[model samples]
Target chain A: MSINRNENSKLDFLLEIGNIGSGNALTSLAEFIDRRVDMKAPRLEFVDFNELFGSVGGVENVVSGFLINVHGDVNGIMLFLLQNELASEVCDILLGSKLIDLNALDELHVSLFKEIANIMAGSYISALAEMTGLKITTSVPDLAIDMAGAILSVPLIHFENVFGQILLIQNSFSVDLKEYNSSIFFFLEDESIAKLMKQFGIE
Target chain B: MGKKILIVDDAAFMRMMIKNGLTQNGFTDIFEAGDGQQALDMYQAERPDLVFMDITMPNVDGIQALKNIKAFDPAAKVVMCSAMGQEAMVVEAIESGALDFIVKPFKIDRVLQTVSKVLG
Candidate 1:
């Protein structure tokens, strides 16, 4: 099953999986909201660490995220982030109710948010695993309801010592026939990339 | 008590979510475990009518736990919770005698449907 891959070819392969994953995510989200969900083509980018904060509002912007650890033939962290309002909107639809203001994240909010991220990422990676013909698996997600910078900082450890740009998929999701747009992000390491290719005898 | 159910996952939050979903559907006779080791022990202690087991975990994972439980009690009704829709893994679980599987980010109705079909 090995296919020869240059750096560009490798990323192309991964991005293909990203496309499938994002499509799965959008479908799952559409089902959850019981509304139409649309997504623009996911963009692959390499952003500087310091400037990464600006892509999603900023480091100080309040956000909610789901953190998943990829295991097996490939190993890295996959993250899904959404703006605060959209996250709450999703929760409202999922629970079939709206809640009043809350400056703090309570147990219930975190739980619902985690499940949303769980299904989204679970479907994403599951599709990726199927596409790659590798034994890729994911652990239970860890959630963060905090400032964007704070959330990104924790996973930064997984990226430590690696210089240059951080690679990611920037996906835009439009939910429920509304023009309101949201986002989901993913991060996989170069080592994982190599491992995945190696499994298919692509050394 | 109603039909006893056991949920096995590494995350307390997920365990709570599934439990809440089950309770909302009037299936509240439930027990929880953090990982496969605890799940196996609880399976013996609780002898739940059916089990919902997550595939990935810190300690003894779901596959090993499923094997252990099936080995211990051949009649154990076990269903796997798979994060990825991996064909090989699904095949392995089925080979290990899993009754069925449900993917994560579950809809409550889907969960209940799986439960009822398995219980029947």
Candidate 2:
């Protein structure tokens, strides 16, 4: 079941929405560091859950991820993933603090990283809400500092009963003379997708 | 407490972020609550001069908590700590009783500015 084949215009619509979200997220991130963050055009796609691992190098890559379940007008899971070391660097840049070892994380380190994810995810959804005029509320964010595949598996599996297709937005961000990449995966339930399409009047 | 500031959020980290910014900027008496219910209780107990709260949380959200505090103390100084996309809720908070609203991933300068403006 190819989402593009059935809903070409819908994919385009979501791509634009994703672009707005990615742009907004980068802008907020830039503010966090009090510097300009460069962003590339966001790439949106629909792929199988298992293939997600292959999209970001391999399933075994150690990464930091934030999972949020969206409720209200539409229901879905949103995942924010970035490489582990880069996640720590993001903390360093955003907090104006440095870590002795990038791989190691203390309680505060994890908290800071999770807070960053929270803001990014919040900004992403905020753009969607504004554009579609939907009442969207996000749940408490769950952070996983582990293999990318393992962390994403939880939400991907949770949506298995309801959805097979996953929509991902890859956003490239560069700040403070360094570049880091992150992806936001939006797995909407079948009904949720219908609600979103109806809101935009997409057939 | 002298010019106490109350920060509310489910994420301990977010509270820490706000507290860090305020403390660095010379806010001595700072209080924190994990949710809206606790924020209401703390507001009643502490009667802090300013309240900074997140719009979303587990037990009680920022909006309901703001309303509760405003009803309890009509002159309570409340500032909503909202995430970017919560424009609607921010508006509702302002309409209810919030002095102003600040978006998250907040800079210390912006946070301080909001606090000062609210104080004035």
Each model's TM-score, in the order given?
A: 0.82, 0.90
Q: What is the lDDT of residue B97 in candidate 2?
A: 87
Q: Pick the candidate with the highest lDDT.
A: 2
Q: lDDT at A168 for candidate 2?
A: 86
Going through the candidates in order, their DockQ values are 0.47, 0.60
Candidate 2: lDDT of A45?
A: 83
- Of candidate 2 chain A, the 10-residue stretch with the lowest lDDT total is A94-103
- Evaluated on CA atoms against the true complex, candidate 1 attains a DockQ of 0.47
Interface RMSD of each: 2.8, 2.0
Candidate 1 chain B worst ten-residue window by lDDT: B9-18
Q: Give the runs in model 1 whose Cα sits over 4 Å from its true position.
A: A1-6, A48-51, A96-103, A162-165, A179-185, A195-203, B9-28, B57-60, B105-109
Docking class of 2: medium
Candidate 1 chain A: minimum summed lDDT over ten consecutive residues — where? A1-10
TM-score of chain B of 1: 0.95
